[model samples]
Target: MKKLIILILVQVLFTLGFFSISNAQAPKKKQILLIGTFHFNNPGADAVKTDDFDVTTIAAQQELEKITNQIKKFNPNKIFVEWEYYDQKNLDSLYQLYIHNQYESYVEKNFKNKGNYDMYVQNEIFQLAFRAAKKTGLKQVNGMDYPLPMPFDTVMNAIHAAKQDDVMAEISAYTSGMAKEANLKRKTMGLTALIVDLNTEKARKINSGFYIKTLNRAGQTDNFGGAFSVAEWYKRNLYMYSIVQKQIQSSDQRAVILLGSGHVAIIKKFIEDEGLYEVVELKDIMKIK
Candidate 1:
């Protein structure tokens, strides 16, 4: 009996020691910062377009510097932008030009036909992501944007097919009114102020509410306008998350995602659900120093 008891105690001690060692060797948790930003160029391309807010102004540039400084505190090892994944080569070429002080040449060659070069230069991808990558000494920025085949016309066709003209009109008027209100606020409050407001918990919750409402209302008609619209949006974000995930090699990697404010609520939720990352809020980082 005495020998048996000693043997049992020895096994228990060995097991405990092994577990302690294992715990100590476990990898550290990865930190992901999801930064929701207004497009600096103000291209007026989104569903809710704000009046052009120029980031090239001295005051705007100064404010952008402050924002980037705060972001630097996170010390992200990788930076991802909202540009399409397939266009990553173009992004890389642009970054190379940016670093070499050949930005004008790059724009004239690649983007002269797309839109205004000055406006493109001021986009958050260049203004924020490029600067962040440069500041952190990162060699390149990653483009994880995937454009799904959903368009306004496609959704409208579905609605029309279902013969839900009334429903479509009502939703359009409601959304357009909301957009006008938001645009008016942006004009009144200034760009930084508007962005700060949008990054708040209230704004996130509102976005979440809007998403839920869309999902609920989409199934109301048999033609599948609302449902298809919501599904496409959801799929886009999910694929974006998957692309971001692919860039993460180990738990030691820390990433900062620069995307539109509208995407925050959905992407944040997906990150939380993954159980592998700890989402670092910009609000928390802004409070530091």
Candidate 2:
């Protein structure tokens, strides 16, 4: 009887151990969406001149309708955007302020007349986004800093490093040529198509070494301050990643991140560097021709 009992006990332990190992090796499931965008509020002629103005005017009601529909499909519990900390807390106040005037007035009061405010008003991306969030009952979180002018010296250093063997100059020339070509095309074609073509090589050559060098030479002192500001920009963005990670992990639903094309690359970089969260690209949903 004792021998029989020992054999049965050993069998049970082996089965339990096998099952535990299998469960431990199973893949973890995640729900994350990263959507890249053109700055709807950007009123500058950059897009216009570069043939990159797709959807020049963001149709507020139509845009909101699309966003809300996407939300319904994804059912994300959290929504993250490129906004300031204070704005996140008082969305209602922002909504009120945004609706009071067109994009031009908002730009005059807040943006220092840097971007094309008239274009932003016609586009109405910000207002529409705000409205969508309110109507959908989604929680909003800030994702990035304002597009303040960068320091020149630090930028020069990065450029110098990049230019070690004339690499920066060559790349800059290539991108500038492409941007110029796109700009020429914009005069005849629809803005959306031109914008897409321009985007095809945005990161590769758009600003590249030229912008870096310009920033380096802008200031009186080191100019390094703005030059090195990219790191600071990354740090701020990473903080948003940390916050979103915490928020999403605790929730039962998924999360969606809405940001500019520039941010798309960085956010993906952060997720990979952290090795904590799994991120899905929006391109997976849309058919990008």
Candidate 3:
């Protein structure tokens, strides 16, 4: 009876040890660093433009290096950029050439003109995302942009249907004025300061404030322009978040996303809700002094 009892106890211990080992080997939570930035080239394509800011200057390039160093401290295993989803193959091919030290010359030869510089070729994708990936030995950067058609017409039609054209005009005037003032401030403050400011909770709230204000304009009705506006924006961000989710592999325990400042609040909210990732604040990591 003593020997039989000893054998049973050994089996119990083995079972407990096996389960413990399995639990210990479970996949760890992913760490995501979301870096919200202004388009370095000032493409003039966004809803609000910041005037034309040249990033190719010596001073701007030095500031960019500082920013990149701060990002590097995060030690991201993967990088995601705001390129269109359909362009993933092209982005990957570019990244391959980038890692091989052939991308810069290729870009210069193909994209440069005497007076025209293509933001598509030399913007944050190359300055920050590509640089960080190459430094960290990441083979590729994922593109998370969904490029959905904007629902401007839908919103406008709704406004007309509701006879709220005046309301929309007022909202547009107020938002555009505020955006213009902010852009002027950014122009005065310079790049690093603008980037640091934009990544803060305060900046995020400011952006969210504009969104919510517009949303509220839809009134309590179901088919208001505000409702359509809110839905469209939310839908785009949700799709982008889903794409970002797909890029996460078991091996990618750390990832960084580089995107426009406007999208940061929504994306960060999505990530927080997901509970699978810990969002590392750029302000904390960069700690600009």
Q: Which candidate achieves the best lDDT against the true structure?
A: 3
Q: Is candidate 1 or candidate 2 better by lDDT?
A: 1
Ten contiguous residues with the weakest lDDT in model 1: 212-221
Q: Rank the candidates by TM-score, best first.
A: 3, 1, 2
Runs of candidate 1 with Cα error greater than 4 angstroms are 1-28, 108-114, 158-166, 219-221
Output the lDDT of residue 127, model 2: 43
C-alpha lDDT (0 to 100) for residue 288 of candidate 2: 45
Candidate 2 structure quality by residue, lDDT tens digits, 8-111: 99999999999999999986755666665555545442422243344434443454465456555666666677665445555445555554544346656765
Q: What's the residue-level lDDT of 210 in candidate 1?
A: 66
RMSD of each: 4.5, 7.4, 5.7
Angstrom error at residue 52, model 2: 6.2
Candidate 3 local lDDT, 1-289, one digit each (tens) = 9999999999999999999999999877789988898887666767665566667778777877876776677778888888987788999998898989898788788778844456745588887788888777787889989876666666666666777766688668866885787678667876777777788887788786766766446543667667667777888889999988876887777889899888887899998888999888666676755
Q: What is the lDDT of residue 242 in candidate 1?
A: 90
- lDDT to native, each model: 0.77, 0.53, 0.78
Cα lDDT, model 3, residue 76: 85
Candidate 1 residue lDDT tens string, 1-289 = 9999999999999999999999999977789888887777877777765566677778778877877787777778889999999899988988988878887676778778676775667788998888878777778899999988765676666666666666577667757876877778766775556666777778877776664564335434455666677778889999998998887776436899889887877898898888888888766676632
